[model samples]
Every structure is written in C-alpha cells, then in structure tokens.
Target: MVDCPHLRSIAPMKTSYLALFYRSWPRLASKALQATTANLPNSFAIGLFCVAALCAAPVPLKAQDQDPFYYEIRPLFENGEQLGQVYRFRNVGLIQCLNGDLLAFVEARHDVSDHSEKDVLMRRSKDRGTTWGPYEAVWGHLEEDHAGWKDPAPVVDKATGRLFYFMNTNESEKRLFYMTSDDSGYTWSDPIRIPDSLLRPEWKRWRNNPGPAIQLKVGKYKHRMLIPGHIVTHEDRHFSVVWYSDDHGESWQVSETAVQGSDEVSIIELSDGRVLMNIRSHGELDPGLDPAYRNFMYSDNGGESWYGLETKRDLPWESGHGSLAKMELGDGNLLFAIHPLVVKRKDLTCFVSYDEGKTWPYKKLLHEIGGYSSTIVLDNYDIAMSHNHGFRGEHGIDFVRFNLSWLTDGKEHANPTVQPLPQAPESKATDRAIWREDFELADRTILDGGSTAWKILGASNAPIGAAVSNGKFRTSDAGGEIVWQTGRIDIGDAKRISIAVDAIKIGKFNNSDSLRIYYRLGDGDEKLIESLSFSSDPQEDFETYRIRKHDINVSGNQQAQVIIRSRINGDDKTLYWDRVEVARAE
Candidate 1:
C-alpha cells in the first residue's frame, strides 16, 4: 500500500429545505463566499436570509434533478500519461475494496499497433478514480511473439474473498489458464490451465487472441459479481466469443456472442444489478455492414444467456465498440459512456447508450475514434472512457468524460424510432438447446444501402460441419472435431451471367481453396459469385486461416439458393457458423 493525501468533503445532510440549496452551491462560489460569510453565526434562517444577504445573496438551481444526461472523462492517475507518469494502460476490470483502495486490471499493451504482444498489466488507485500508483506487471511477457499472454480477466470472489485471474494459455491458440493472488494483488500463483474436452486445437487457433479481459468488481450494491472477457484478433474478420464466470474465476464457460464480429468484450454491473456487456466489432470494413463497432448485450438472469435480454429488447445494435456504463445522475436518467468506431473507415464516433443499451438515440458524434475503451461509475457518478485518440494510427489510451450535449452539439431526440421489425416467421433458431436449429428469414434486407436482397439463415446450437459439410462449408461438435458434408447447391441460371466463389475455412488447413456463392434466380439463370479467399498462412498449431475467393458476379435477382463448395485437396474439416448472412449485391 502507498500513502495518499487527497481529500473530498461534502456537507452534512440539511434538515431544512433552503439549507439544501446552500450546500449545493458551486465550489468556486462557495469557496469565495465562505471566507466572508458562513463565518458569522446567526445567518441562521431562511427568514434570516436577509442577514445572510447582508453581505451576499444565495441562489438555487431549479430542476437540478431533471438535468440532462452527461459525463466528463476523469483520469484515474493524477500523474497520468499527460498528468505525469503512473499506470499507463487501464483494461476492463476496475474494483474498489472495503479498505478504500481501488484497482484496475489493464491489458498492458505497450504497443497498440495490433503488432506487439499484449499482457495483463496493473495499477492501484488508492483515491478512487482520482489518481493511481506505480505500474505493476501481472502477466507481462518479455518475448514479443504470438505465444505471449493477452487479455487478462480478474475477479475477486465474494465467496472466497480471493482474487483470481483467468487468462489465456501462452499461445495464440491457447486454452484457458488461471492464477490467484491471495495477498490482494501484491503476490503470486503459477498459471493453471483449465481443460475441457470440447476444446479443439484448430478452433483454438481460429480464436487465438484471448482477451482474458474483465475482472469481477464489486457491484453497485449486490452480493453477486460478474467476470467477463473476449476472444480477440487482428485479422480482417471481426468475431467475438464472450465468456463469463458468475462466481469470480472459480470456473469459466462460454457466454454468448456479444456481437458476431466483435473483438473486445467488457462487462459492467449497474447499481440496479443490471449487467451490461459491450463488444467492439470491426466497423473498419463496414460500419452498418461490418460487425466491428460498439455492440451491446444484457443479462437479467445474471449470466446464463443473453439471447433474451431487455437491452436490445428495444435497440438492436446495427454496429460499434468498447463498453458502456450507468451512473447516478442529477436527473433520474442514467449515464453511459462509449468509444464508438466505424468499421470501414476506422473512423471514431462516441454516443450514449441510455436505457440499458436498449437505445442510443441520445448521441453526439464524439469524433471518429477507435481503440479499446472501458468506463467507470465513480462515487460522484462521472462517466468516462479511455482509448486511442486517433482513428487510423496507433495511439496510447486516454480517458475523459464528455457530455451528450457535447456529442450532439445540443441536438434533441437523436435516435429516431427505426423501421419496425418487419413481420415475418418468428425465428426458430434460438428456441432449442442441445442441438442446432437453422431457419432462413424469408424477408430481404436492403443491405449496403440498396436494391439486391440477400437471404440470411440464423442458427443456434446448430452444429455446422456435423450436419452438412463440403470442401467449402463445415461445422464441428463441442470438440470442434466433428465433420459432415453436403456437396453443393447447384443453381440453374447460366445464360447472361457466371458463377463464382471465394473460399471458407472454419478451422485452419494446409490447403489453398475457394468456395463460390452459388445460386439460381427466380425462373432465371444459374449464377455464382466467388469472392472468398482461403488463406495459405503457416500455422504453429494444426490450423491456418486462408483467404479463398472465386472471381465472378452473377446477374441481379437471378441468384438462387446460395451455397458454398470447396476442395481442400487433402484434409477434411467441418465449417460452422452461428448464422449465415448472405449479401448478394449487384
């Protein structure tokens, strides 16, 4: 522990109503007046107000409770990066102990270029969010290779009062590994790996970047805590597989996909026991089209499953990233701070997720920024997020809380009501548990901002290669070992167009392959669009990520029954997907 000298004092409760207004005076005004007044004794009553007004009169703020939602980023380190020098990077988990010391678990990323190795870094904030201590390395790896640890998830078990860290094994395709700190982060425990027969080497390689993010923090006011993290990557495709632990880090299991194409996952619990999970998807490829952006998920049953949370019950994320938080507001409205980004341009946009991530209609474009961000709700309830300032280059993280009024430049009712979900077949994909279910949504979405309609088939618990696999598409069982097949879906339209495909590789392989998106339009020509490229990258494990693509585009609307086929030349693997969103553009 270190010595500290920061002090904050608030006035004792006032029994009289007008006294409340006097206590709420602006700090500067209160300080100036206190020197002259508040010293004299009998400035006593509201009726004696004139005696108090003998020197100066007091004013009151009307409708203070109805104040608009706002937040100003506060740095945890007084000698922060800019302030001076203290803990550099602050990851997801931020916890305050009973003894009055605060702590944060940060992905000690000295390099944010998607190039260097990342590890778990730490800092102690003794004075709440005001300042931090000297930096400490919880899991820093000296070697700069993909084999180093990344994303460290820390949790202080309420049951054990013990601090446990669930991080990834040393390799990119590593399994879950953990360690414990008994002496309140001042000590040690060798990393221990958790084994589940369901883990597949190839699949592990596919999700090599383990965030190991999040450390369970004390809830606003509850016994239950939450532990969360994300499977990360630098690859073009944005995919996030979030995992959560209810009782600290005793054990871990798969949570849900915060967003299909998310990378960083962080969870924060509100005072009301509401758990909000934010996943940063890649908006770099396409904000609306690409999944990278800030996306959200909520869990009412703690962490069982978020497929039914009320968060998106109102606003389904079209896309965006980082995380969100709720604050004790002047008005009854809660405050949220998020670092937003657009996938295609790598542009940044900041906004507010007001109603438990249900909708962010109250948004202000806080610049086109990108990078990891996690916010906190201090005792006074100031909300802020830390992230790289630029949208294109590598920049160290910084935090600041700005208001919604600042973001929208005072705009009103920003998030307009969207088009009502079109009436269609109620989705049957998520209804089952043990097995997978696949149902195609009959309606066509106007994607890429236009005309062509791409059919989408969403699946849940559905085994990919296990049910049907060709050289192109595959699915596996829990172990990611099962492989099945359905050769190809042949289309009939061939005349005024052509057929083509890229490639698909659920798990890595030695083969260079491609799979074409094949289809037959209504009473028209058979066509195929091949644009996927399967990778030929060398693998440290049994898998590889290949980019394969067929070079063809078919006539509009003539595309029928989209199908993918591939020839790996030697190995056999099943390709799987939670859902298939087919966009057959013109």
Candidate 2:
C-alpha cells in the first residue's frame, strides 16, 4: 500500500536579516572609515558593506505558503502490478460497514481497457482508509475467466446489518448477480442472479450498468434498499433507473425509467423524501444532439418513479462516472465526486451540498488526472474516495481520505494559478477577432475543452483523445473519434474567417486517418468547412494546417463556432495542436 502523507500546517519562519544588516553595516562602514584614515586599502571593507546590504533584503514567501491544502491521496491498485491475475482496476465502489470498516471493490481488468475480462476484487481498511489489506478476489476466477464481473455496488441494511453486494456478468446472457454478507463483508454468500420477475421484458435485451446503492432511512421507505443503475437501449438512447428491495435482500424490483439520454446514475434522498438522481448525459453518442452536461432528476414514490430532468449548470462535469453519498452528519449535507470538467477527465473534485442537493458551495480537488470515481461518507463524518488514475505514469486505482474541514478550507492541492495562452500575431491589432486560445499555460480550474476565455463544448467522457498536455492541445487515437467545439464567437464586420493551426501525428497513419474542421453559424448546425486526410507516408513531425477564408462559407452570420475532430485508427498515437489563431479576412 502506497501512502500519501497528510498535509501539515507550516509556521511562518522569522529571520532577522534587516537587524543583521543594520549591525553589520555600521561596523563595516566604521572599519572602512578607519582603513581610509589609516592609509590602508578600503576596497575590501567597501565590498563587505555591499554584501551586508544585499543580505538585508526580506526573504521570499515559501512554496508551501502559496498553496497549503494537502489532503491525503494513496494508491490502492495500479497497472502492471501482480495483484492476483489482474493487471488493471476500474469502476470502483467503496462503502463503510456497520462495523466501521471500509470495504472497497473494483473491477479487476485483465487489460488496461474497459471491456477486458474482469473480476470483482476487494480490499478492507479497518482503520478508516489509513491502511488496506491484500487484494481478495470476491467474484470471477483467480485464473483467466471468459466471463467478466463488473460494476460492484454495495449497500448495507442498517436495520439488520446485512451487507449486499451487487454486480453484473459480461457473458452472453448479461445478468445481474448479488451476494450477501452477515458478518460485515468478511465473507459473502453465493452469487444469485436477480429474479426475472424484477426486470422489465424490454430491459432483457438492453445493456445494464450498476452504480452506488443506498438504504433509505426516511419517510415511507425507511428500510428500502435502492441501487441506482442505467440501461443502454442504443448508442443514442439510454436512461437511468433504480432497483429496489423492501424485504432486506430477498427480492428486488426495477423502477421506471427516469432520465433519457443519460448513463451512470447516483441517488441521494432529500429531506422531503424525494430521491435526487444525478445522471451523466450521453450527448456524444448521438451527433444530432448537442454536447452533454450534468443532468439530474427526482423520484418521490420511493425510487419506483422519477421526473424532472434538469441540467446542473454549475457542476459542469465531463461524461464520466461519478459518486454521491449523503453525509452522516444530521445536517442533510450531501457529498458528490466527479471529474468537474466539460471536456476532459482531470481534476477529480469532491463537492459538499449543505442545502441537500440544491447547491454545492464547497469543493476540493482530490486527483489531478482522474476517471470514474466512487465516494463514500465514513462513519466518523470523513470521506473515503476511490478513483482511477495513472499516478507517475502507472495507471490503477487510488483512494483519497479527507474531511469536511479539508474540503471547505478554500485552499487548493494542485496549481491554483492560471497561465495565459500566448496571443497570435494576427490577433494583435484585429478588432474582428472574437476569441483565440494557444494553450500555453496550465490551469486545472479551467473547464476541459476550454481555456479561461473560451468554453469547450465536447464529449467529457473522451479523456484519452482530447486534453491539454505538455504545453499543447493533444488529441489521441486512444480517445476514439473525439470532437470538441467552442462556444459562439462574435465576428464584427469580417467577410470571411481564417484559422491557422499547427498539428502533428505521433505515429503511422491508417487509411481513415484524418482531421476534420467544421463551423456552426448563428443557430445552424455544424457544416464541414475543411477535411485534412493524411495520404502521405508516416510523418512523426508537426505540420502547419491552415484554413483559408474562401474555403468556408459563413452565410453572413454574426456569430460562429469552430469544431475540431480527429478520426484515427491506431494505438499509442497522438495528434498535437498548438499556435491556434482565428482572424477575419484581411
């Protein structure tokens, strides 16, 4: 187990440089005067006096003082490690048992990718996330198994203290299976497939994915066990629902579909007995629809039905899995964790909502580069989070431990300063130029697919394909058909728009490898303006790609948007972009 040291408060150091200078200057000056009066060399005395004056300057502030929030981040599972037969871990699930022990479950993948043959692995932290035990294969085989066990959702029945663990099998007959542990997760019963009576006939053909589960403690559904989940009907149509059991773990029933065009749902019961479901929008799966945003809904009939699909404008997260849990503190505070970006999956952030799930005012960044996070409120009011990341170039699962005070302390763990992108030469004196981004600086707070000045509109789930890395905007084939667009930019009295970009392909290109650029004019859909396909031999160097004004037809629209997308077929291949300039016709 790799341990991340806790951040300690640093005391300001006191140095008397001014006093030393004051005492040394007088003696040095007196010695210089005596040397001059005694007809001896005074050059050495003068140099000593100059050195004392330089030493009197005040010391600069320490690096720790500039940014002081250092929460604990530890590694639980990483890539290339011999943790049983698995090489990677994904889809994390964490819960604190009635016995005050932390049970963390993850999908142990045979490969780094998502669809690899997988198993459900477990680790227990008896001391509240400070330490963890060895990896135990709870489900799937110790050797390679053709069937995959995915998406572990654990919920403990407070009334009976029985823990239920639910997961799905990736076999030909994708079915939901669950096990129970009476002794607080030390052991689990045999895997039992969910009864056919609980599932809708339409859902049998659809792909189902499970998220975190919660045991309701309020109103008419006091002891109901609700597991939030979703089913993908097609590439463009998916919705969220809940599977509930009122009789402990004996029988379960599926709820009505809540939000359409969404995936990976998490639910938290509000004070008024309404369950709030947060869904990740799947706009990227359908090009006819706009880019996705964080969406939400509410169910009042004890998780059986839902309504009100509202977009959360403030939370702006990428299209990835997030976790939500209600704090045990009787104040009705809710804890949420996500990638907190519109385009890229970086900066895993934890948010606290004091007024139920209405608003989130406090947040803390847990990991710089994170994906698919699971959060659980501990028995002692602290938070234990398990997430996916490649720390120090090794990808795996990591756990973070923090509290409410650490989250709301207003200090940041990563770089707090936003670096300005370099200005383009064409934009220096042009009044018609609306927006430009060179991505010269690093700012974690800036939304993914966007800088401080422009908002990037794209699929937040495509992290491997689109990101700002190594001082350049990079798009890789690993991200798979990535498309990113900017918000509308006003064009003032410009007949035509021109853009210049520097791009490069990191590896050999295939037949379908190409970079396509498009623009959307005033309430119109995106229209292709230029498509650059690589037909030449493999080129591993950067090349300038320019879009002339005559190549595009703006149709006299006052506002327009530019879209950049990559269609490549290869592995470990990247396309780097820099020095992007947009200007009016000269």
Candidate 3:
C-alpha cells in the first residue's frame, strides 16, 4: 500500500475517503466533474464546491491498500468461428463444479437466429479460468428433426456434490429435461424428462428462457436449489417463474408465476433470507408504453410465492437479458451485469449493491459493445463474466476475470498494455451570435469564447454509441438527457431566438416518442422551447425541423443555454441532431 503522508492528521473516515479521492482524482476528476455539474455556473467557486463534495463522498477501499487481484480476457466462443460446424454461440451459463473445475455451457446454434437448430456445448476450465479444454457437445440432434436443446441452467447440489444441468427441448412436444454430471463435468448422464404434472396446463405452450440458478444458503429453505426460468405467453406477454428442487435435482416442483409481463429473470438470496428476482419487463403489462427499467419481486417462502413487485427506476436497462449474482464477500453485496443502455444492447456494466439489490452506487464498465451476459463468482472471491462482445473486430462470447478490488478501487488489473475504447465526443454549441454546431468535432466541448463540454444529468449512464459521429449528435436510446452551456451570451438586445436542425430516428420511428428541447436563462428553471415530435413519414429517414422565432420564448433574458432531452420510451430509436443553428431575432 502506498504510504499516505496526510493519514496521521485526517480522521479515520476522512482518511479513507480522501485516499480514494486522491488515487482517482488525477485521472477521473475531469470526467466525473463534467458528468455531475452542467447547470451550475462554470466558475472557480463551483469547481471548488465540486471538489469538496467529492472529497466528502463515501469512498471504497483503495486498490493499493487492498489485496492484489488478477484480470484476463479470453474468447470462449464466437459466432461462425467455434468449430467448423457450429455457427453461433449464445445463451451462456457458467458453474463451478464440485471438484473446483469451471464448466462453461452455451447454446451452439447452427444458425445465428434463436429459433435455429441448436445444441448444448461445454468446455471445462481446471485452473480457475486460466485455460479451457476442447469443446464437447453435451447434447445435439443427429438429424434435421427441428428439435433443439437450448437455455442451459445448472445448479450444484451442495449435499450430494452432483451438478444438474437443466434445459428445455423445443420440438413437436416441448418438455423440460436435465442431465447429471458426477465427475466435475467430465461426463454426463442421459437427459431425463421432467414430469408433465409439474407444469400448469396453461403454461404447457410457454417457451423457457433460462438463467442462473442458486441454492438458498440461509433461511428455512437452506440448500434448496431454485432455477430461474421465463416463458413468453404471447407476442407481447411474458412471465418469470422458478423450479425448486429440494432433493438435489432428484425431483422438481415449479413455483407459481412470480412476475407477469416479465422475462429473463435472475434471482439471489439476500442476507435477510429473502429471495429477490430481477426481471426484464415486456411493457405490455405496465401503463408506460415501453418499460426501460427492470421489475423486481421478493419471495419469502423459498421461491414458492412472490410479492412486493416494483419497478426499479434507478436501474436503467434495455429490454434485454442480464445476469445478477450475490457476492459472498462483505455484506453479501449483489453484482449485476447488464447492457446499461435503455433500448440497445451495448455498454456492458457491472453494478454493485451493498444493501442487496436495492441501490447500486458502484459501477464499472467492462465492455463497450456488449450483448447477453452471465456472471459467476470464483472460488477466491474474484468474478468471472462471460458475455458477447463485438468490438475491435472481435465478435464472440468473451470471458473477463476480475476481482472486487479491480471493480471497486479503480485499478487496472488485466492486460495493462491494452487501452480502453475511446469515449464518444460531447456536443457543444459555438460561441458566435449566430451559433452553429454540426456535431462534426470529435470533442464534446462547445467552441464559444471558451470551450465548455456538455454534461450528463438525471442519469449517470452515458449515451449508447457515438454521441457525436458522422456530423451528428445522437440522442440516447434509454431516455437519458444531456445539457450544454452557452456561457454568458448577450441575447437581451435581441427580440426573439430561432433554432433549426435536422433530425431522424436511428432505428424504428414512433410518433408517440419524440425529442424534447428546453432552455434556461441565467440559472433559472428550464422552460420548454420546442418539442420536435416524430412525423408520419413512410420512409425512415432524416427530416429538417425549424423552430421559428414565435416558437422560441426568450423574454427578459440576457444569457441562455439549451437542454436537449428525449425519452425513447424503450424503443431503440436514436434521434440524430445535425446542423444545429441558433440565431437572435432571425
């Protein structure tokens, strides 16, 4: 640990907070300040205030003061490149065997689509994820019978030390089946069908989207293994349920519907013995047209019944699959690995919650361009993450090995030579009376008399991809917002203000969802300036939007700045802004 000269004079709490601030201050201070302060005046007083606030913030343990950890990234499987025969690898499931070996399982698709013919593939890592054995087809179809084995969910029996890998076969008769691995994933037993009586008659036709299973470590249901499963009831309806095996997978009983209009759930037993299930909502069940955040429920009866269903507004996520696991370390912290965007599958971030899954105050971005992910805690309190990343021309399922120190202490642990991907440039307005921003610059700073960068607000998440690219500044997919300051522009002499820009939907266009714009003058509250609703254009393309002088209301204000916001409403529609021109009394 680095010796701190000021430790002697500082209090215990202040010392810890200051140590973390000092370690990350030099490198991350600029970005952190930019993200937190956008509305306040850019003066030395505000700068000092921000610094003081940061110093007083609660700090995690510093990396130098903590035990050393290791991090490594390796491709486990890739699309079109695993074996000569397998074309796609998806639906990752990881488990540590009884013999301390790591078993990585995935769906080997004959084609890229989910409905295509698939099989269960496995690889064993004996040395704590340092290396892997060759691929093994655990289950597959010999002929084109249109039957496929998908969604592998594995749970180890603590009492028997036997691994049970559960899966569902989608054929003329959809059925739940499982295999047994006695020798640490070296070999497996033949698939045995789960009793049809375990499922309700109305749930027979449901398709299972499997996720991680956990054994309750505490409470009355100790050692009970619960496998999280989801099924799509209709095109726009889905629900999450669990299968409980009290006898170590000898027989199983399905739980009642835990959450409605939700799918792809991950459950974790909290320190209080309550099981919390995080689910992906389908939006059809909520009043909101598109639900961007995850829905959660708690079970007190060992996965038998669920209650306390609520939307996690703090955790902003897209309508995609994510993984959650409980860290066996201090306070039994919960770690969530998800695509951090609202409507797109990107920015794979790991969030840590100290008080179970209630509030996630710590986060780390693991991959810039990511898809479905599964997380597993290693034997040594380290973390193993497997996810699909398509960045730097590497498109496949990659594994990342890291520890709590690397995640919380802001230390570089793995492959220090490899630099992280550069962040997208911010969008800043020019300082001229007739200011114009084409968003052609790679920096997010506005080129007024003094350059000022746009700051993120309301949410800590950044834009999904390319905030400023191809001569445009794109809005985020998840209804996040950003603000840019114009400094002290003298527009008091001018009668009216006008703005013109080109806008287009990034993906599919929806008329109900539109980009909203607002403006504030000299520290006043932000007022609505323009609302550029999507037009009924048959073709999905860009259209010019002009805010005339009458639409702009800048009365008795000498200095003003613009605030651009949009709620994509869970649709992956990105609003692109280009050729933004602001004028006075034009």
Supply every candidate's count of residue pairs whose N, Cα or C atoms clash at under 3 angstroms: 77, 0, 2
Clashing pairs in 2: none
Clashing pairs in 3: 426-444, 431-448
Q: Say which candidate scores most in TM-score.
A: 3
Q: What would the TM-scores of all predictions be?
A: 0.45, 0.56, 0.57
For candidate 2, what is the lDDT? 0.63
**Model 1, range 1-586, lDDT digits (tens) per residue?**
1111211011111211233233344443545555655556654433345444543443421222212433333333222343222323423455444344556665554344333455566677654444568666665432212334544455455445566666553345445656676556776454555544434332343232222233333443243544454443444444445454554455556644444455555666654565666654553432332342344666655554554322232222333345555544434445454554354324334445555455665443333454445555443333344544444223444444443333343342222221121122333332222111132222211111123222223233333222322111343332322212112223334323323222224345443444434454445554444434555544322222222223234444333344434433333433332222233222
Q: What lDDT score goes with residue 62 in model 1?
A: 26
User: Model 1 Cα displacement at 176 (Å)?
Assistant: 3.0
Please give the range of 10 consecutive residues that has the lowest summed lDDT in model 3.
Answer: 415-424
lDDT of 2 by residue, 1-586 (tens): 1112232122111112332343356557656655555644577766655665565544432322222332466688766655446467777888877777788988887775556678778899887776799887676642213456788888888777788888876653236778788787876554666765655656543334444688887899988989877765534467677788999877888888865566677788777778888777664433322234566788888999987767665576765777787764433455464554534667666665667766765555566677777787655555567777742224788887654445555342222122121121222334244567666566222334444244334445455456676456666564357766666777766667776555555556656787887777789987776777664543222223445344344567788777778766666455665555566754
Query: Local error of candidate 3 at 532, Å?
Result: 68
Q: Give the poorly placed runs of model 2, Cα more than 4 Å off.
A: 1-70, 81-86, 142-145, 204-211, 234-236, 283-292, 330-332, 390-394, 410-586
RMSD of each: 23.8, 26.8, 26.8
Higher-TM-score candidate among 1 and 3? 3
